[model samples]
Target chain A: DAGITQSPRHKVTETGTPVTLRCHQTENHRYMYWYRQDPGHGLRLIHYSYGVKDTDKGEVSDGYSVSRSKTEDFLLTLESATSSQTSVYFCAISSGVWQAKPNTFGSGTRLTVV
Target chain B: EDQVTQSPEALRLQEGESSSLNCSYTVSGLRGLFWYRQDPGKGPEFLFTLYSAGEEKEKERLKATITKKESFLHITAPKPEDSATYLCAVLASGSRLTFGEGTQLTVNP
Candidate 1:
């Protein structure tokens, strides 16, 4: 298993409320990514960070924001959560380019917005 | 836009049965193809990485092979422990990976 951890393994919240998920890695990988998994949708990347404070948007970045202040921590924030945002969120890390090296993933966070 | 598609959303196999899962993809510049296995309530675990067409990789009873447009994950003499969702993804030149919906495999003892 990879040294990756996602906090609040399971969470339930009301719609229109602020929600934040945390991903911490001990591997000191250079790349970290936040993705959401839904039924029939597979895994969709919301955001990614190549280095400290260097981030980029993924295909499903709308209504979500991420920040990576240090090498080990990457945070994903949903300013105002919606029912549509309810999904299983996963965090992945890679020591080198993802295409060259397989990404190690954290257990995951199951969030529900009602 | 790069896309990945997996067929037969779910599969059922008896223990010792051999089978394969398919992943078809289209990417601008192919960099690599990846296979991951996920048990219920757990994140995906990396399985294999195929770089070019005709490339093959193996681990235990699992084998992954790739071609120009698709990849296949073959399992031999599967066991109950092999039950899981198998995910396929393609990493293009930009380091972004596009994933398939996955094939849920159930091996019964």
Candidate 2:
């Protein structure tokens, strides 16, 4: 029940096409993250932003990129969509680093690349 | 790498049945352990946060306890609505949360 929302709740795009997912938070949290959820992989972080204009790659950052223009918005972009990139994407926000406080997750965005 | 493993990939309990789920983890310095409930198609809902070994926290029918290397989620008199995937994650020294695969529970009526 956090004040987090993901845009384009659902999207479908062709392979090799560009795709971007948006995460917006009204809480002004300092940390924002993008993760993809797969059946056996659970949730794997693709990218994270600690502050505006600051970003870092996660375990599965390959082919994925993120940008934070402001504290309230985090964007995840897939250079070129691939069938393997199809999964439920979740955006999480935390007031403090995950080590200090638990993060709040958005409902999620389901993306399918055919 | 810091890792978390949850057991009983899937569980089924009849109404009123009691059970427990396990979350085993390996971390350099465990700052905190958290439990979350995620219904299918919905983001996880935070349940409890345990700060240290021998610590325990409870809400309604769910209770969470932590030890040096693992954590336990015990369900009491579970109801049909108590069905969902229970996820466990650890907050390590640097504030990164490494999550477990989760245990999917189904409480039949």
Cα RMSD to the true fold for all candidates: 1.4, 1.5
Model 2, B23-53: lDDT tens digits are 9999988988889999988888889999899
Range of the 10 consecutive residues with the lowest summed lDDT in candidate 1 chain A: A95-104
Query: Which stretches in model 2 have alpha-carbon errors above 4 Å?
Result: A98-102
Q: What DockQ does every candidate get?
A: 0.71, 0.65
lDDT of 2 by residue, A1-114 (tens): 568999889999999999999999999899998988899876788888889998998888999999999999999999999999999999988888543443689999999999
lDDT of 1 at B40: 95
Please provide TM-scores, in order, for all candidate models, with all chains considered together: 0.96, 0.95
Candidate of highest DockQ: 1
User: What is candidate 2's fraction of native contacts?
Assistant: 0.62
DockQ, Cα level, model 2:
0.65
lDDT of 1: 0.91
